[model samples]
Target: MDNLPDEILLTIFDYLPPRILWSIISKVCRRWKNVVSHRVITMWDYNKVLKTHKGVVAIFGIRHQTSRQSPRGLAINFHTLNIRELVLCDNFPLGEMFMKSVHSIKTLRHLDVFTLQNLHTGYLPPPEVNSIVLNNNIQPGYLLNLARRKELKALHMYGRSQYYAVNEMSTMIVIQAKHLTHLTLRCPEISDPRWLVFSQCINLLQLQLYACWSVTANGVAHVLQLPKLQVLHITGSRMVRITALMELIPTLSRSIVELNLSASSFSSQHIALLAATLPDLRKMEVWRCDLTAADVLQLASGLTKLEDLDTDVELNSVDLMYLSEHPALKELRCLYEGEIINDELQAQSHIHVRSALTAPFPLRACGEGPSAGVLLHAHAYKPIDGVTLTI
Candidate 1:
């Protein structure tokens, strides 16, 4: 081991986990310490290491801290490390200082700044950044400036402020509408004519709106005009009027593949319309919607290409038996509290059944959009344990 060159040693160290590399390998020798210091290292909530041709990129989750004190010596110097993506979650103490230092990095492309409470004043992404996900209480003026950047391709902003700046947000959407392919907004104050601006986003593929109560059927009519939309997720919105959904389904039926309407009021008729119009639908999530067991069965029978289904409707043994025989359905996630007697059926079934008291899907803080490699490393799905099935 001592005879190996620095290049070979660096390559070998890249495969080791962040904990081992930082604690053990870096202490072996002066040369090892020097090489390890130059590698990608940052504070994260969990230990995730991604190995690339250049070197190892370590993603560490930031632990929640009660005090305002920042972690000593943990501030990232972007000029030294070649970080391609950075995510700052809620309760991060050094968010402002850290964001200020990010301007030095030349390789950064994706930046996600999410804060539920703490507001990082004067926070802004550098000019090179193209994809941004913000869930902070930032000023609308800052967002207006961000939208004017011609290189911006993806923008996701969650509503956390008491006042919604409709004019500024509308202008932002209009400026970048032509270039953005992925856009998500959670504001509840946006409605009607403002939604008309979205029609200009000709290249949009994925659109998610959360808790936007003011956006009625009329507003959605405009969004359906996008030519390339494929994934549409509208949760907790009062846009479930039957007539509107039925009329809008056909416009996106041929192109849409994934649909999530969680926490919305969707009836049997809506499900029928979706199944009939959307032939290519593969993933559907309707948790918290009112649907009978028969409606679910009818949906599974109609959508031959459906592979993933998430719902809150309780499925009896017979329903489980029917789903077990489904040729295309591979996974079913049920968010039910009561006991389900399907032990025997589950043992003999090929479909994976998971039931939890609560929903497992959380609002992702980072690792989505164009960077496939980073998304895989940051947001890999972990299955949650379900309640014990009896009989």
Candidate 2:
């Protein structure tokens, strides 16, 4: 083992998992320490460790572990890892300092930051994570700085957060992140039209906004102009005006693939217009709406690509029969109380709420968004050759 070339040894170390890298390699002596400490090797997380006696022996070799505190209560467990995607939960002490140091992890491609409380004051932070999750009281300004990292791809910042920014950072940086793909912001402020930050993110694909009370129709209209947005999810408790979106949506035309609305008032007229214009829409979900199954049928006939409808509306046997008239729709999440008019639509669709996975699907309940990986929903759908079939 000692005779092996340094490059070869380093290359081999690259394959080991993050837990193994620190727990296993620390026992290999100072040589492996020097090799492993090289930031490049430790930047991204890895797994699948070697099974050698030497490899097993190396983990216990470290002399001292990292100290527990620094400004921002920063702890660099170099022995720890920077997993590619992150979803932070639970409360952390010294949240400011933690966030500050978290910014320096160049390999952090995805992140979810939350929980902000009063700090000791005057806390300076570092640039680290890429994708972000802002859920706590952390001021918008700190988030702006955190957003500076160029590699960020997805961001979900919730409302009711701390407004700690004395100076507004450039929201423009968000648009500049050339790789950003998905974003969800649920801000409840009734007067902050922050969508002006969307000018540069021309590559954005999926967007979801909830409780954006400050968003005027004009701002949303501009978002429709973003060119690449495929899915839109809007939900809020406040009274938001849709007049601007209504006017702007016609011009901001695209082959939108998906749309999710929770408690939206867009009427039958609105749905009719959307069906006529959005020729590429494959899926649309509504939590509560004024449109009926008959209106849906009319809209579906024109929507050549419409494949799924997730509605809270009930379906009667007659309604189900009417629903069968549209060939474009393959699925419907119908929530009806009357007689069952179940048809082919119910047979082809995979309709399960983010929460319902626990009830009927038999799928494992898990986290949301990026961390929402698949769990066994039904035993019958277990992996066959290599793929799992949906039941």
Candidate 3:
């Protein structure tokens, strides 16, 4: 069908499975190749497909169902295909083949390699890869080599189970990742010395650490010096010195706007410290922590720019009323699994919430307002149904 129009050819190609389209159909003719380059979308999940009969045949592009040949028997033309993203599902050998055989290296931008078997020689990534997510127990030397991929802008590595804790290699990697803006580490084996490696990511805007216990107060204080940091989320970290966190609050730059803390025991004093430190915080969330009504009130009183607040703290009716009346709180969600709010408190919130819901807005001139309808942010409280407040 070289004679067919591009639209019709695209519609026909769309009916074929992605595996056949990419491997078999795209290479049929020059016209098909050009159309497939723009029309075909590639997102392969290796494990789920290779387990079934059709999947095996589709992935290998077997000509006949009765063929007894393995996938390796077929020489797939990865060189001519246009692949946008590649996800390796713990298949290190397959990953190695793809990296080496794929001639369209500069076209590949997002690469996700989870659970690396080992760092085999001659299996390096392409230079154009920008985002990488690694969840394998790779050696420090291997990690250092992967860091050498100079174009990486986002790097997420989970190395908690590795035999060797990250040391100088991690620091060098961070130093090399000059364009890295987002960094996530789930390695519990990372010690304070390794945590210091993060300070070198000067262009970093978002930082997320999970279960990294070796991060000390000094490490966090040093990270706070990053001027462009806007979002910081830390959870399940035990070794982070709260004393250091409290002391370094004032030192944090104004770019810090969103903060999320969970699975940590925090007192009223800690809440007060946060209020003093983050007066311009736009969103804050505290979960599974020890906090009282005074702590919540301190947050309500101090943070005037807060639009979203969520906490599992126990709050009384008066505290709820004061928060509902706060000018900046556009949405407040309180989750109390340990104890339920009493009926008297619920009734009060319902009445106040109803009033808030029906509060009038200045009417816009005819034909000047939005064509569909005005979107409103509704204030809601749980365990008290039928209470919807809007502004």
Candidate 4:
């Protein structure tokens, strides 16, 4: 039924993102299914392949499996698994057991798991019983060893605050993964960064810090050592103590070029200090945080590299005119802070600035991580800033 050469079709299919290809193929007739499932098929797309597993299919997509206990559980072919990307998601009873089984896949280069929180260093399987282990905080040394392996490239973990001891427990586990280029932590209510992990990963280029425990002045200072890092994300920081930022901002302002301090506050000194020090910053985001128009004036006044700015405050035509003409201004974001932010009496300052930060990115080449799209979307703004809030 096909007139085209096999090689041509294979090449076109190979370029498709595995996740998308799998979605279409899985719905076709049975003969096609058998061919597509073959282990030697060279292009095993496990991106969304996790969804196709019988374990996931049984729960009907709503719940990931706690374990592969059922006789109907689909067997995963290690040869077919592209170990470079693995997702170990748990939805039920034996989650830890399932993750432990995945740990055995030796060729694994990237492993992403969403598991319960723990107090020990490295990744921990379900809670263990024993006062002796708990009292001494004895961790299975294997996890730290896992962290040190030379091959692992990315690691992501999220857990409940009740199970974590903050930084005291995680520091060694993190530094051990010396080759990791991407790291994400979603634990909330952390009090310190001592166990914060990731010190020797000299190659680390991207980091996502969401609802992670707060950094003390010392913790903030420690972040300055991450010289190779390029992108930063700080969310859910209302609980963040101001003292920690006061200590941390001076060190961070100069080093990071892309800063995302959304939903947090910075003092007058921090705003002013960062404004002058961060000469290299290319993009910035400030959302739902309390910073007066004056504070905004102080922080953003000197940032020539800033291309996009987002905040939850009001601004008027005068305020718009000043920012619209400012030397560094390109895109402005407002979050309808009950009333617009810029005032009439003080808006004329930017009438002559005319900042030219936004440039053209073809978007033909995609970014390396998840938030890459957001960065591209941020560029689609101008200082005659737009405001929208989700209800």
**TM-score to native of every candidate shown:** 0.74, 0.58, 0.61, 0.53
Candidate 4's C-alpha runs over 4 A off are 1-73, 77-79, 88-108, 115-145, 148-151, 159-162, 165-168, 174-177, 186-201, 210-215, 233-248, 253-255, 262-265, 297-301, 316-333, 337-391
Q: What are the per-residue Cα lDDT tens digits for candidate 1 across 80-151?
A: 556655555555544555666677767666676555553433667888878776655666577677776646
lDDT of each: 0.63, 0.47, 0.53, 0.44
Q: Is candidate 3 or candidate 4 better by lDDT?
A: 3
Error of 1 at 190 (Å): 1.1
Return model 3's CA RMSD, one decimal. Answer: 14.9
Top-scoring candidate (TM-score): 1
Candidate 2: list runs displaced more than 4 Å: 1-78, 92-106, 116-128, 147-151, 162-180, 190-193, 236-246, 321-331, 338-391
Point out the higher-scoring one by TM-score: 1 or 2.
1
Where does model 1 exceed 4 Å of error? Answer: 1-60, 66-76, 91-97, 115-121, 159-164, 335-343, 361-391
Provide the global lDDT of candidate 2 against the true structure. 0.47
Q: What CA RMSD would candidate 1 show?
A: 9.4
Task: Single out the weakest 10-residue window by summed lDDT for candidate 3.
Answer: 368-377
Q: CA shift at 259, candidate 4, in angstroms?
A: 2.1
For candidate 3, write residues 1-391 as lDDT tens digits.
7578998987886566444566567778887877765644332332222233211111222111222323232114444444444444443344445556543545655555443365443455677766655545555466656665565676655433334346645755566657778776654577666667778888877776655456666666667767798876665445555666567667776788877665444456676677777788987766555666687778777888887776655565566777766777766655333334456655545322222112222113111111001111011111111111100
